[model samples]
Target: MSNSSTYTTRFPLLAKADTPAALRTVPGEHLGELAAEIRAFLVEKVCATGGHLGPNLGVVELTLALHRVFDSPRDTIIFDIGHQAYVHKLLTGRFRDFDGLRQQGGLSGYPSRTESVHDLVENSHASTALSYADGLAKARRLSSEADRDRAVVAVIGDGALTGGLAWEALNNLGAAPERPVIVVINDNGRSYAPTTGALAVHLSDLRRQADGARPESNVFIELGFAYLGPVDGHDVSAIEEALHRAQDLGRPVVVHTVTTKGKGYEPAERDEADCLHAVGAVNPATARSSIPAGQSWTSVFGSELATLAAERDDLVAITASMLRPTGLHPMQEKLPDRVFDVGIAEQHAVASAAGLAMGGFHPVVAIYATFLNRALDQVLMDVALHRLPVTFVLDRAGITGPDGPSHHGVWDPSMLSAVPGLRIAAPRDTVQLAEQLREAVAMNDGPTVLRLPKATAGPPIPSLARMDGLDILHRTRSGPLDVLLIPAGPLASAALEAAVLLEDQGLGVTVADPRWILPVNAALPAHAARHRLVVTIEDALRTGGMGTALAQACQDLAVPTPVITLGLPTAFVQQGPRAALLAEAGLDGPGIVAAVLAAHPDRRPPSAWSATTLATTPRGRDDHH
Candidate 1:
């Protein structure tokens, strides 16, 4: 039942056994000193492993104050996104294992109920803590026992405040006036980037007010909840006082604590947008370098989107507070009016895009493929039902390594394909992404989803321009085929290499990279029929994913190809390098070779394919055939 599979020994400073001595018995001045120590420890541990940095740094004081003031496990505290729970992890008996954070079989990236009693929730997605808190509060309220007096606190970021689900929870919590729900709003003025929309502006103006002079009845108050704060989040005494005040209110109350995203650290403090919201890796001396120079899918999308927006005036981009990551920063800068960052409101983002499409505008929603799950209802009902042509550029379309299971977009293709009138295209590289994006925008159809991996951009393949849909990448010389390879997207590159190794064993192999890959590729059945065995590979889950889809597709077509599908298992995957995860999942070049050669043991031919170079075009169009 564990989320991760990695384990590690404890660092002396990060040992949880020393927490009581570090703060509880120490002088009041020690809290600030301890906070500084904890921040440094977090920066060091997380920078090596790469995790939610700015968030943990920002919440150092808040987490310290919370742990000090309230008895956790008894007093339930739920972090909304849980991305900012590193501070909580450090204090509540997980300090030693923090270095193993997000690795396979190691400490989880987010708060996990299974990890510890202090960690109340295993949340990774945004804007659900309030609802969970409300439910917990209601459970306590309806308790028959007279002595159930534990408090329920939900810590949420301001970016999450813009989501409609949070508002829905607010309305419900507001209805029950006597329910004890403390909604702590950690307003740092950003969500991946500086938050957008009029509400953010209002919050900014309110924050600008001197301490006690701010308006009492704002949005949260309007919902019949007591509202407090605009308090300095870094002040341990002040934050503790605010939490005490919130608990004393005896009703659903929101405490607006304004903290800098990366407090104490000068570089993080000066960061304009997300403030190193989540760092990759950096040298201890200089916290800077990341994985070597390679164009990420986000960079390609950002650059291409800016150019696309420049050419088409009717086109408008919408993101659920992910401007920088989704590659909309350039568009946001150049066409500020056109780009709409609807805070962390994915549902609203989709519904609003539908409205734009209705008004004769070509609206493109650029969202993380995982986040897109939140807005599916809106996309289906508001956009698809209305036949509004809205282009959904799904970034991180498949296994997003290092972010863990919650952030992986493995099921996106399978989920979206189920929605009628939705056409999904899985691109192989940057050129295909650009062309497909253009095609998706130009077609005045209902809805189209473009699924691309994280940062698969490189030099375009020379034979890319003429590639067609569902074409075979490798062809045997009319020999009895031992294996037929089917790779979802760029995994085809890996399969190609595996095929070379398989050929050396005298096992005839054919590799196919279906550029316009969907769950239901008609060519797959006929293609599979030609081989003795068919193996499907994709960077997604095996259950109800691309592999399953391909299996079902082959079954439906009456193709009796004994298909051995490889994909992510029906378990939560941990965080790691892309190569590592791919190899572990048996989808990388070496892994694929191992699996293929294991399946068939016979002849040994010379290798045919070289190192795979994925083009953004269809495989059929490639002249290599």
Candidate 2:
């Protein structure tokens, strides 16, 4: 059945409660029916489009209760790990746009400021909403507006509470006892995987206390905030009652609500691992993914790491609540004692890895490239400064699609390039990822980073030759080399295609993949001197990225070759397909051809051949990136 047709007839209650104002008007007796309908609608649309189905399904009743209790856009409701705000979106007149969820130029997977006024915080990074709520509440209290008394609610998952930022915000919010902030702890007990550390244990104890074990000294109470029940999150009326009490407090309060992660859906509830937290296109009825099984970069990394772990007793793994997602599950399953799940604390994970490395063990820290930004200080000071032999496996290293700006990892290269003693590797294929993983772990002097994209691994691009540890993928067969193409990671395919096209146009092009893209390969500047123009393509920020580093290397060597850098602009790239975003940023095969032709000395006028002219000339333009 068509989505439009299914959407129109299947959700009568959902249709009526299109907005929060309309949701407040929903009869209390029919609120249950509305929640059911919304869950059904979510399964129907989100399964087809692919999104955070499990988290959204779990929060149907909780979201409905929040809308009924607080006047949003005025009350200011912020959801930590914004993927859980799917139900909030449905309540805020976004139900009609569900069919286009996470698509290019469509509704985002997480909360988006541009999509609705209700969404104040656009960043979907976990454990940040509490801090935002704290700030917003303080702002509201000091405001002279008539509606300054409006409530500020922060609905954060128990998993998110594991993050250090949440505690930091809690410390500040609790210290200001006069501030009226409603901190709702949505205790689902999972973030991607099961929540770990002492916090989870404490929350588990709280859940036991709710079952009439004994009244213990509550942490929230000790933190200087009024504590409410460990209420049932799935019960809308019960949640609303707790919210009412919290609202009546007129001071900082904590409403601890117990809920299941994948509440309503049987498939999600039954799934042991992350409750099917995030999914691709799936069969709506069975809740089975429809995406055909393939060897993804993640799986390859996981497999290789597991193999490496079997061989080396000194190899251990650490993940910040992303054990399975970051491809550490294989190693975790094989050597359970060696793998550590540090909850949602990236900084702790990196610093702790450094500690482990200090104890004579090589700790492999598996994390998303985007999340690694949170631990930059630890990476630089704790690891790199100490010359710790820690391997950071950065998954989703480049232009990750769907999750949008905060999730796209285009800034890692720029951010980590200056970290002394840190080696960064951008693998071109699954083979390279495995090889690089092994090589990274083998290093004992300093930290190493192996970055790979979120896409499925492509066939290996065999190198024609290896020079100074660089893989020469393509070289001018029988003509003068006019352009030297340096592509980072998966962009080697596009560079190879552009090389073929440039060769056909009678311009000889040499393509090379600098396996370790950091510290500037020693042989690159010398080889680049042979070509008239050097083009560096990467799925990273153009500023201070591999391209800039390469250009700097040439300049240091007095290589007079004019360099053209093609990469994402230094801006937040929005939600879209990875390929589409790359093409838009002019990092694709045809785009590379256009960039090369525009900068080629033979194609451009003699006046344009000057270094200054080549630097200023427009090549690939992506204003959105």
- Clashes found in each candidate (C-alpha, N, C closer than 3 A): 20, 0
lDDT of 1 by residue, 303-383 (tens): 888899999999999988888888889898999999987889888899999999999999989999989988889988999
Please give each candidate's TM-score. 0.89, 0.96
lDDT of 2 by residue, 1-625 (tens): 8765667688878888889999988889998888888878888888888889888888888999999999988889999989988999988989888878999889988888899999999868889998998898788778876656788899999999999999999999998977889999988878888888888998898888886855656788888898888999999999999999998888899999988877778999887887378888889899887668778899999999999999999999999999889888888888999999998999999999999999999999999999999999999999999999999989888899988888898888899998998999999998888888889999999999998899988898999989889999998878798989999999999999989977877898899999998978888889889989899998898878788888888888788898888888878888898998888787888778777777677795333324433442343432110
Clashing pairs in 2: none
**Model 1 off-target regions past 4 Å?**
1-22, 144-147, 212-216, 456-468, 593-625
lDDT of each: 0.76, 0.87
lDDT measured at residue 529 in model 2 versus the true structure, 0 to 100: 90
Report the error of model 1 at residue 236, Å.
1.2
